[model samples]
Target: MVQARIGERLGLAPATVSEGVKRLVTEGYVEIRGARDVELTEKGHLIAEALVRRHRLAERMLTDILGMAWHLCHEQAEDWEKVMTPEVEEAILAKLEGEPTCPHGNPIPGTSSGIPWSSLEPVAALDAGAGGVLTRLLEDVELDHDVLKFLEEHGLMPGSHLTVMDTAPDGTILLEVQRAGTNPARVALGRNLADNLWVLPAL
Candidate 1:
């Protein structure tokens, strides 16, 4: 129920949210201990809570201390979400003693433990009207130059809008994304790249 509620609040589907819960279970981080509810095991609670802490703190640090625009901070925070170390997170918290939440008003992850959180699925899995912020892109050259160029030229970096237009029978995904103003640019994201790029639902 908690996972489902969080998903609803974030505008993501329950299935997608379940993926995160399942990963936590597989890693011994969460468990189903009763018939009526799911509970985070101690290990699960620590990791999940810590991630929330780091994410919120990072957002606060970026916008409050560094003066990043609200829209501009998501990408940087997304990258930091995966890489924040316990020590680094603590240092940030200590530096900003009164900070308790992200600029978006969500609670921060409480610890800096180096646990990797679950990421959103690829663009290919997305529905036509659904949009999300590109959170991360694994680096590759020969396999990804076209997609990268298309993304860069159109301003489709992490935190940019990614809306699927049409999916080809052969598996190519057509995407429409926002540029500098007004209309969005139309581009085709091939199957390989689409499968690798992960995103969080757009706010």
Candidate 2:
């Protein structure tokens, strides 16, 4: 990642991001590569892997055990990841029986050796009548609480079957999803939202 991209993603000022990145480089957690890109060192990658594992495991516990809403799990899991000790992480993992992905369908680092799905494409890219199983809600979309809630309420979670019904002139994608115990229903998603949803094309 580049320093500017990091700043933009985290909504931080350039100066603040620069200072932080400098500190990280000094501490040996990150190394500057090409002109503006940053890469994690082995030590940094280990720490990151642990953090990501804990976060995703926490999300699983929150949603599968506490009945928390999928959209709300990420925020709460952020705190959980930071505070959990190794013992606590193990206990949670035992309870979850080594679940492979978070509620939004992103893989939990260290949980599996292989990627969960291949050849994923955004829902927005599907042509009318093309369909697939929704595989992932990208990180940006998972960050939006309202959007996550809306997706959850409309059965747009990972593994749901969805087909593109049509596309609007404004770039909105109309979709038909197979909700549990209900007939397939039409729903409309704007370009941004549709672009954030990844699908594994049905064979």
In terms of lDDT, the best-performing candidate is: 2
Task: Give the alpha-carbon lDDT of every model.
Answer: 0.65, 0.86
Taking every candidate in turn, the Cα RMSD to the unseen true structure, in Å, is: 11.9, 1.8
Worst 10 residues of 1 by lDDT: 108-117
- Residue 188 in model 2: shift from native, Å? 0.9
- Tens-digit lDDT track of model 1 for 99-177: 3545433335443322132646667788777778765554331123455455566655555678888888889888887
Error of 1 at 7 (Å): 5.2
Q: With candidate 1 superimposed using the best TM-score fit, by how many Å does residue 26's alpha carbon deviate from the native?
A: 3.2
Worst 10 residues of 2 by lDDT: 109-118
Output the TM-score of candidate 1. Answer: 0.42
* lDDT score for candidate 1 against the true structure: 0.65
